[model samples]
Target: LDWSFRTTTRAAQKLPENVEEILTEAALREAHLIRKYDIPAALRVNTDQTQTVYQQGTNTTWNKKGDRQVPAVGIDEKRAFTLVPSISASGELLPFQAIYHGATPASCPDRKSPFYTEAEQLGFRLEPSKSDTYWSTMAMMKSLVDDVIAPYFECKKNELGIEDPDNQYSIWKIDCWSVHKSKEFLSWMRTTHPKILVIFVPGNCT
Candidate 1:
């Protein structure tokens, strides 16, 4: 059978040549440092965010013949959020942080959402973006550190009996998102979470 297959190129291809080199060296250095410092797997964590739609899409659904629609009622095509999750090398999963669209949630209407109560019960935090396009920003990065990462770090430190602020360091591997590498954010992270060793993967290389 003669047929054609469509292929889509990824944005990662446009990344600079230095990106791979940087990523390779960073990973090697991180591994070396971890071994040299005897850092436990429990403290080595990697975090990433994935876009999630209010409604999930599927293919090959069971429907009446010639029917184009699958009847997804109340599905907001425009509504979306990012699910940021962290997992340590030792398999410890941290509570997810969700970035939702809007400056502030409308309590009356939003609180009634079916996903609202369950999201809260699962410890998913909803943070708003000024433009409703929830790209990570310096302020958001700071908020994540302050509201989520910092407290988690403290608790893990205490639980692991990892005292001595110097050796209490944890490896935080995050993608090299622009905001994550911003000067203001870096400065703030360094000063605030001195025990956290932040490592950035190649830009868009994830």
Candidate 2:
């Protein structure tokens, strides 16, 4: 077996008390929600976001002697994409969404491309965010709730013979971020998705 040592970033090295509280609350909330709603594991869902970069870094590479830089074939190393995925406690998966930086991809065919519509058919949504280093914003979160979360909640409720609107509930977990703290986002969650409760993980924990 081979092993190597690596250094983690400041965020990875730190584990604050707030993180503990968030974990505790998450567990308690899940238990309470299940008991109160009589929810099956299949109906309880959680979601998180992750980013994928197009570049790979290597410490060792074969090259001509004293070559200034080795030739590498890859897409823009600095470019990245964020993916949001949801899965139920029972392992049921919801359609995933991807966020890109620009209004349209450089590879897009035309100004009136049906790429987005095509993606929708394949159970994925590809969209652009406001910033180049795109993090999920209030608008994006709202769209996520409306187009993905709400629909999934309804589908699960129907499948489990729980149609009493009032009785159907969904538990969605997300990290604590500024975009998620918007008044509009909170109000939308409360009113538009009354049955779907969004839980925030502790700040700096995720």
Candidate 3:
């Protein structure tokens, strides 16, 4: 199986051209199949309690520093890269898996993700808290793969001399969103690529 951590900017810059390249060139060159997909990042929200009081001798007052649920935007841009290379073993090409890591919740602060520490270490400034934007990025990547990369592969298949009719390929773009409210995206994915698998990863409570 092909496994990868979430995407990071640094990681994306270092990956090969396509998923196929990594599978063929990596040590797992003998494997018959490979699996690759983006892992949704974790998210966190502030939960504070508030109290209101009323008294005959004192003025009424209300406190509003209560709980908040914010979506995190972590690791989304860090692992976006293409892979497209295979090596020769025993003079025969083999099936391979390629993956491009996408975003994660750990990268966002409002989401209380952990990736902010790394981003700071890397000299990147954190952005202000905002609405969860992970799914938007996922959709964008899906469009890129569908509109650009897939067609390129079709064109190159003949020139590259690829002859395996059983060879299968897939693309996975991931993001974090509320399961209760993200039905729209879910529906879109189901209608567009019903065969693809979708996995959701939640954030740590602490």
Off by over 4 Å in 3: 1-145, 148-173, 178-181, 204-206
Please rank every candidate by TM-score, starting with the best: 2, 1, 3
Best by lDDT: 1
Give TM per candidate.
0.74, 0.77, 0.24
Best model number under TM-score: 2
Q: What CA root-mean-square deviation does each model show from the true structure?
A: 4.8, 4.0, 19.7
User: Candidate 3 has what TM-score?
Assistant: 0.24
Expressed as tens digits, the lDDT of each residue in 54-139 for candidate 2 is: 57444455689988987765523666777899888888888887777766555222436666666667577666776556667776
lDDT of 3 by residue, 1-206 (tens): 79775433323334334645544443242122232321111111111111111221222233455636433434122322232222222232222112223254344344345765554543332321123332223444344335443433344444455454124333232224353127765676667645333432222211
**Which 10-residue window in model 1 sums to the lowest lDDT?**
6-15
For model 1, the local distance difference test gives: 0.73
Model 2 regions lying over 4 Å from their true place: 5-11, 17-22, 59-76, 105-119, 130-132
TM-score of 2: 0.77
lDDT of each: 0.73, 0.73, 0.33
